[model samples]
Target: MTDDPTPGTRCRACGGAAGTVVLDLGEQPPWDRMPARDAPLPDPAAPLRMWLCAGCGLAQLQTDAAVAEELHGVEPLAMTEQSDRSVGRLARAGLVRPGGRVAEFGSPHGGSWLPRLTGRGMVALDADAVSAAGRADLVVDFYGLLHEPDQADALARRVALLAPGGTLALQLLSLGTVLRDDQWFDLRHGHYGYWSLPALDAALRRHGLGVHRAWWYPLSGGTVLVTARAGAEPDAGTRRLVDEERALAVTEPSGFARLQAAADDTHLLLDWLVAERAAGRTVAAYGAASRAVPLVCRAGLDASLLAAVGDASPAKQGHRMPGSDVPVVSPDELAGLHPDRVLLFLPELLDEVRAALPQVEASGGRWVVLGPGPRAVEPVSALSGC
Candidate 1:
């Protein structure tokens, strides 16, 4: 709860000269700069703060979150499932038209909307290829928009690539959900913007695009699929989403003050882990996700506190959590350890992980979901309820 030490004077989306400090996570290593196992104890730290633009509702990272380098991140099964479901719904809604031209924006996670669209009798074009291939009937961006350093330019380019009356189906982690769930951890270095329905409406209007339809999914706490078309009017569903954001005060920086509590509570995890070690409860963790990087470091954790972190991605397997001595191991190695408690950092992966790691339960070990504090994973996993 202190004001941002490094205040951001300009907004990324609307080029507003001034904005309000929303949430600050102090200084932490960039998520992509994962140190090698034996490299060092502390990596470089940078300001990590979220700012809310008064002119536009967009909340963007005020501090720089530049990538030190590239590290592959495996897409969770939950995301794959959600994509399939999203495509089906979009097609039913007539956005994915037959013989329609589709363009997909870049995503760090390796996957393509091409094959899925081609199978539906739609032509596929990469967002980059749209220049020669001409405008697209539908453009899709999922979790890619926030990575752009220039938010206004990014949106303008994508909207320009759309054909007259074309739709842009954007799926973003709902800012409303982040505020409601207090997911301050999402405020990382590389992620430049957070989108609420109201905020996105303002940003899109700048490019002559208007949101016409919207849908919600449970993936990533909450995800919103918004369909916008040039000069289109907001449908009832879209209006409702904007109204919901207004109710949450999404446009007000002070409204996001709740996030500071989550920032304060992160240290509780370190405390719990320390006490668990003292009590002789063998503890290890799963999911060496980029999201877990700062939490691992800021808590001042090491292999002594957390035995090891398990990740499915082979790229991260040999590398350790950045800024800490904890090693990232394969899921098989993690299972071999059989620690009494396994902290599940990414709670949304609970169902898929449960099916894949039955051995943890079979071996008399229980999975604990990491929240503000640790909570035992019940039969039905729920992040907010936990």
Candidate 2:
């Protein structure tokens, strides 16, 4: 609650004060705050800085009141839809079962998953909800624990919520993979902490919990499904994954430098977009994802540069982007537009998008991914033809 902009001096996981500022993304607003068509735009961006903890190696951001205010305006409907698949994944992983009591923390809309978990007791609670302890057979928190200032204490409470042998499953961005690729787009105001396997292991062990099983999914760039239980020993698979993260130097200084280098090169994509427009080539964008908001605002992209932003989601279509006046259209409409080049903001969805838009390839419209290094532009010839 200090007035200082750099709010996280201590490690959120271990309460260590030796956290070092590794990457500074300058000032950023809430990436998901989409202003209404006639509403005034939000302004006065807050400082967005990432720190690496020397004690536990957890990467966290400096959050303050301004950042919190910006995040409060985010629409929950889109985020809720994004979690639908992850909920199913949790069920398939054996975390949710018939006759078991399941509790979901930080669910945008309550009862949205009741239909899916029929015959099973389901209770949806906000992140700050308090209730009787030791109640649930399984507790699922999707990208919520990281937002807490005291993640360790929050996790301990979650552990207490589980019955004996019950599981606490978390779905969050894997810093091990994100740092390796320097996906700066994932670093936003809403997420206060980022976890590598080693860091998460350290935090869980501190609270008398151990990772029993884990899975890596391609959702949200790269996500990790970590299931933990009390009084359970870490299995071989968990140890191997932790060792792999160590080999990657996810928490070391060298890794930070590499990530900074890639982040500094973000302007390369912006310059390429500007040049393409200067040359009179039609440029359109793919994916109206919330993550794309920061990229668009940072790069100063607008309708002038991108003719239209196409998304597969029906909810986002017919709406304009948050900060920019760029229209959000359907992928089908984009095919008919026959743009000369389609820019992909979400590179993780590259294959899926390419497969869905065969007409763009048949019309010789190339696709470009906005990323550092060799992942810049994809030629039309490389795409599968109709």
Candidate 3:
């Protein structure tokens, strides 16, 4: 079959060709809300294709032609939950125990662990660190236009500057994890090299550093955190971690087949909804921004079949659903309008949705869920008024 040209056509992790279909998210404009309301409404860029690689099991968007160049100097993209939790975990793990000087590479704006590390007597480095005014307990500033040689040299410098027994925590993305689980969505253009565990371990050893501990942490879908110290004996944890990684397969061709089977069952419920719509029934949806919405929308239910999208987040309430442009409203708004059918977006958030179902039922609405299968017509007993 001729390969479809898509946003993530090139595997973001290892830069290999992404193969096979994992999901088709349909068209969705940028999921991340623009920084300002007036930030010229980005031209609609939805209906994207997401793929899973058979070779490494990485999941990614298929045709992101404009991403690389436009992404340079984009700092806010660095704000990831992976960095925050990793830094926090390491800080409490005696990595920066009192009086220990530390160094971090690619530490953007010294976000997450840097400020605390500075307080704990550690220094940071970045492009600005080379300036006389750039001195700190830590000193990492942009090296400007980095190559592997530059990275190796800078890391060596940082290691040399560390106080003896002090630790170094480098939080670069791990290609090993991306390959291990095919979490290609975690790969963005900002990062250059895709560091594998063996490759990174070898580099650290060359720089006269020893891996203290390393483990794959699910910070951003998936990531790896490595804590190292200069000249320390290799940690036993590294070997165990590698063995475990090699044991896992990135892709399960059978799993997607199973998911498809489940999806096929879901179509039956969608057919029921269509029949009801043809008979002129009203239905509303709960949990608009969820991935489930795309699946539901793709199933072909019309606007009248899904009256409006309802969400608890005030941030999303008035916004529009990605591809469908279905208007989003509040859960309370659903109660006021009292649509006859309520399709739950997050079936896992069922308890919460169930608890709120009474208000809908009291106002003459019936509950329905398009889940592993679709069924309807009852308020959950969990809520008081139900």
Residue range 1-386, candidate 3, lDDT tens digits: 12445534555444456476544444444433312222343335544454555544544445442221211211222234445566566767756555544444553222455665667665545532444434323322221112232345555666665544556566555555544433332322222244555545655677777666776665433456766666655567778775565454224333333333443354676777788788777778776533444454446554556777777666666555544545677778877667877777545455556565567766666677653456774565434454
RMSD of every prediction: 3.1, 4.8, 8.5
What tens digits encode model 2's per-residue C-alpha lDDT throughout 121-180? 454443345456637777777666766667787788787777777788887778887776
Candidate 1 residue-wise lDDT, 1-386, digit = tens: 33434544677888875677788777788888777787866677877778877788788888675677557878888878888988888899887767899888856756656677788989887677677447899898867898888999899888978988789888888899888888888888788889898888877888899788888888878888888887778778778877987888888876787888777887788888889899988789988876787678667888898999999989888888877889999889999998888899888887788788878877777788865688877533343364
Candidate 2 at residue 345, lDDT?
78
TM-score of each: 0.94, 0.80, 0.52
Model 2 — which ten-residue stretch has the worst lDDT? 67-76
User: Which ranges of candidate 2 are over 4 A from the true structure?
Assistant: 1-8, 37-42, 65-94, 107-134, 312-325, 330-336, 354-359, 371-386
* lDDT, model 2: 0.69
Clash number for each model: 1, 0, 30
Top-scoring candidate (TM-score): 1
What C-alpha lDDT values do all the predictions have?
Answer: 0.81, 0.69, 0.51
Error of 3 at 362 (Å): 4.8
* TM-score for candidate 3: 0.52
Can you give the lDDT of residue 196 in candidate 3? 50
Q: What is the full ranking by lDDT, best candidate first?
A: 1, 2, 3
